[model samples]
Target: MSENRKKNSALKVILIIILVVGLAVAWIGYRAFIASSIATSEEYFYVHTDEPYESVIKRIEDEGIVKNPSYFNYVARAMDLQTGIKPGRYKLSKDLSNRRFIGNLRGGYQEAVPFRFQNLRLKENFAGALGKNFEADSTTFLNLLNNEALAEKYGFNKDNFFLMFIPNTYEIYWNTKPEEIIDRFSKEYAKFWNADRKAKAAALNMTPEEVSVLASIVKGEALHVDEMPEIAGLYINRLKRGMLLQADPTVIFANNDFTIRRVLNRHLTIDNPYNTYRYKGLPPGPIMMPSIASIDAVLNYNQHEYIYMCAKDDFSGYHNFAKTVAEHQVNARKFQQALDARNIKK
Candidate 1:
């Protein structure tokens, strides 16, 4: 009987050891599964394209994005983070769990980035802004813009290429290729010129691109949003009358001088085709990107007999419209006198 008791006691000891080991492992597995892996101060984590998986792990550690790097590594191994390295900008919270974080990285779950270019003045500036919002280098996009074949592929020349853009933002992946972005914009541009907008452009005896060019002038000249249609109407009237646009904004654009508080006679003397005061009809292309409102204003311009416009002497950002050169000259002289009174000579 004593021998039996000793054997049973030994068996119980082995059982207790096994139970303790199992519990310890369960605690570790639970901790690894539920632990807060992302302790990052940043709202998003970036992984670059073609980056090695090991380098990504190191970046997570170096950036202090994980609470415990070892726990994250163990979970990553379970979720196969090393096998697939998806490059993207992922939205991460401060307290992301190891399981969820690893799953996001492994499954290529990324947040779409927004890029609005409505207000960018120059193509170079637009390309630079794109670089800031995406992974591709700024020059990559600029090169595509400057490429003649690529521009022709989209049915535009370098001069009229700016018309392809809608100036509104769409969902873009952070790591999208430059060529892919241009294609996407081209598709969006096609969609934007639907039958309705096309009919409007046709009714005005203008193509979509021509309307965009005139809209850019309207956008540049009108300071207030309410005055956009009026300005567009005035330009359209001039186009119908076969008169020189004589837009001061075009003169400034031709001279590449934005600091010119006033367009001078010397400014209008530039030989560039963009100088509307010297050239007839539209310039080579749009001087700046026109917003949707500005574009629509040109499509739905106010019809009136007014052939000229001058800024109000009251400095209220409103324009005084006139039907004849005599009335226009009077308005222009008042505005010139107002500028002299304020000493706004450039």
Candidate 2:
């Protein structure tokens, strides 16, 4: 009887051990299955850091990027990723298992916003626009560019730090540091000024910054590329002959109005140093953001002795190049007549 009782106790202990082992295996298998399912889904997810984290997670869940907030929280905690999530724009697969999705978000590899330079008017304006998109301070951007030491380190001379930038679209990692962005742009601008361009600028007795400054002026003067060279020649000739460029754009820029149909003598009397009609030589810096065509025109300006020019008065986007003051006045009169005929005041 004692042996039978002992045998029964041993069997019962064994059974209990097997049952516990089986339950443990099942739980492990279930956890593994959940993790695997989360990793291979096709769900989409996005995060915009403009809002609070809770709101961001809510949006992520609403967009079906994650299966459940609790699952995301659990995975995030388990992987020690709770502190690694970066704030910015992010995109993820909606069908991604909670584990994979949370891991990716924590890794900060989900998305990057693109920075583009379309419809950029001025350096400050472009900086302001970029600030709006990237949550950067525009004042900081402008200050960095205007920093004399920084500008010089980036190959910009004292005379033309304001116009050293070359406008183009750029892809920046989201939430990029402001100083880093400026430094990157400065490096890219240096790259654009290749050895060949540098030599060409040297041959013209100009620095790259000066060339860009003149290019900006040419950019503001004409919208047509075919006329850039002639306009460039005109300005070059004026510089050589010690004549005031007498450019209307400079006067308009000084007055902060390019909409006037005509430039008056009083407009030329504006006390700003940018008024080429009053100030000899080019303005202190570029008045506008020049296109690549204008920059090239400055590098490849035609060798001409022409000192003056006026619009052809045909609205054909052409110019009448002049060699003397008298000829310039005649062309100006013709342009004025054309403007009068069109009832365009300038």
lDDT tens string, model 2, 1-346? Answer: 9999999999999999999999987765455335433332443344545455567666655655444456565555677654566665555443445566566667777555567663345567866866776756788777776688887787665446666567777788657778788777778877888999999999888877778778888887786888898889889888878889888777888898868768877787889988998899878777777777888998898888888888788888778888887998999999999888888865
lDDT of 2 at 26: 78
Q: Which digits, one per residue and each the tens of the lDDT, describe model 1 over residues 1-346?
A: 9999999999999999999999999988877888666777798998999999989999899999888888888988888888876899999986678898878777889998987777767889888988899999899988888888988998889998987988887899999988899999999999999999999999998899999999999999988888899899999999999999999889998999989988888888999999998899999899998889999999988988888999999999899999999999999999999999999988
Residue 101 deviation, candidate 2, in Å? 3.7
- Computed on alpha carbons, the lDDT of every model, listed in order, comes to 0.89, 0.73
Top lDDT prediction, candidate number: 1
How big is the positional error of residue 162 in model 2, measured in Å on the Cα after superposition? 2.6
- TM-scores for candidates 1 onward, in order: 0.94, 0.77
Per-residue error (Å), model 1, residue 178 = 0.9
What ranges in model 2 sit over 4 Å off? 1-80, 92-100, 146-149, 152-159
**Which 10 successive residues of model 1 have the least lDDT summed?**
30-39
